[model samples]
Target: MKSRAYSAHTLSALVLLASLIPLASCRTAPPARPDTAPSVAIDGSTMYCTISWGKRGAYTLSGQAEQLDGSSYSVTLERLDWFNNWQDGWTEASVPLEGKLLLSEAGGSWTASKIEKPVPARTSAAQIRHRNTILEGNQAADLFDRRLERVRATAAWLASESSFSPADGNQFFARAGKVLFPEQNGYPEGTGQSAVNAEFKAGEGMKWNRTYTEQSIPEHLREVRDSGTLWRDWEESRELFYIAYTWEK
Candidate 1:
């Protein structure tokens, strides 16, 4: 026999797969009914799920069981958030579990029979045009040269913010429903936006050098809302502030 080594990425995938194994192969004998819970009380039964990604951290899923029947149930789960162990906190939005899962108990664990997942959200051509229009009016220079790294940095920061915000995880991070430019991370108050902003700057090599409170400043920004596919997905353009502007030194 020969020894083998697995890379961190490979090990993470393995762990995630292992966590899902029980969901697929669950089996069990008839369960004892509790005196307090009725036969169909499963409708309101909630389940919390966590999928570990080894060093990457884990994803949390939760939802109540609906349309219960015997050991069978229809579960509509929403991915709560992604905890990035590397960041010591939630850092990304996870694709929400889509479709009603037809679940059944086999080995004392609930197993999904049929499931559907949503596709990732992408910036549409229309959205790009709208963003361009706004920036154009303000004579903002496009950061096309650093698009790749900047976009990647932007995505990570946005996901991290979404994971940390107490507001609707599916909506874009905003202040009073608006994206404030050049401010200290325009999130709700007392939510440690400064801490997150520091991390974003240090880790991503991006920082805001100016601030504006005038009402006209917002006119130069575009807020495009779209369908969100994950807990980390952005529903508006405010979530992509980095992509929208390239603050020059």
Candidate 2:
């Protein structure tokens, strides 16, 4: 157990750490889209797959384009495999990097109009202790290039009606979960999809229920477990945690 004095010191250290970090190093806007047809096209003819590396870490971006109509297409993209490079090797970490893009045809050429925003990447309080300002402007630029290229390739694959295949996010998640948690049986009670959905519906009338999925029950449980207060808290306030985790961020 952490002493109250130690906890107070930790809080002070976190405050100081936050003030020391530079804003630019912590967050950045996505790179600008090139004006060329190939870079913005949704005609199913170009695809790019590439890795972007920075002093702090590396990530990969790829995408696919699906023709929605004669003038529009839907593009799905993924930025995956975030890794922090260290002296020894690399450490895998979760980072938000999946999104969709909408494109429209104009002047006999396809062009992307907007891209859906993915969930924001976050740094945990625990991580802030050891994290440094990341130099990643070039990395973001590389991701932009790779996204256009991959979209082109996937669009090319869909050029022929016989080859058209749409991407399904849920199916992808199911397959990924199998590989990531091979031994996992199922979600805990009240944590299943339907149960969680019902919990949300019930909380729709509650003023305090600011629906968000970032603060999930599993994450809460993991935090408490790491802090050696899981069992104690579970017995004292399990239901409260469940409802709070279910309906609020």
Candidate 3:
């Protein structure tokens, strides 16, 4: 009976050892690592992304981000009309983005995030002043040109009339004079009267009739007049004559 019991006990111990082997193997095997690399793609207005820690890519952003604390920001991804054409649509999303991107890992994606350090201003005070001055000058010149065009058009119409009276021409010139002399109408210094007077004086003693031709007007105005200088100069010069004749009347 004792010998039989010892054999049974040893068999039971072997069975228990076999059962623990699979468990031991499981514990010793290494854990599978997660797939963690940054990637992004766009389809229409939807943006798909697989961004890993500490990386960034190109993106279009809108709205403001809170600088005081790391907060969520909004971004947009535009879908191109064709592979080589312009964007036709866009997608938007709000995400908690913080810290400056160290490097760009991919293209065709938009990322919106806050940086720890604010970006330095690209334009200086002097540069802003210079740019503003140029814009203002351009605006002033455009206004002057438009006003001069209206005057020229009116003069041309008057000249086309078969019986243009000097009295009517003088009346028209008086009304349009303010536009020709912008300085008198509150324009700044240097935005003085047009070169019309100078041109008229240069062409002094020239025929002051409705028969003025393209060859008669000043070259400067002739060059820029839209409707060829022939009729324009004829009308304009005739009006100038009326202006001079009626000045002392």
| Candidate 3, number of clashes | 3
lDDT of the structure predicted as candidate 3: 0.26
List where candidate 3 sits over 4 angstroms from the true fold.
1-135, 167-249
Selected candidate, larger TM-score, 1 vs 3: 1
* Overall local distance difference test of candidate 1: 0.30
* TM agreement with the true structure for every prediction: 0.25, 0.23, 0.17
Error of 3 at 120 (Å): 46
Q: Give the C-alpha miss distance for residue 242 in model 2, angstroms.
A: 38
TM-score, model 2 to reference? 0.23
Better of 2 and 3 by lDDT: 2
lDDT of 2 by residue, 109-225 (tens): 544434564332332211211244333334533442332233222223223224222233233234322321222324323434432443231221221111222233233223323
Tens-digit lDDT track for model 3 on 1-249? 001012343334323322222121111111111112322221223322222211221111112221222222222211100000012211111122222322122343323232332122111111001111322234433432343344344455445444333445445444333322222233223333332343331122332221121333333444333233323322323333232222222
lDDT of each: 0.30, 0.32, 0.26
Q: Could you tell which candidate, 2 or 3, scores higher by TM-score?
A: 2
Best to worst by TM-score, what's the order? Answer: 1, 2, 3
Which candidate number would show the highest TM-score if scored against the true structure? 1
RMSD of 3: 33.0
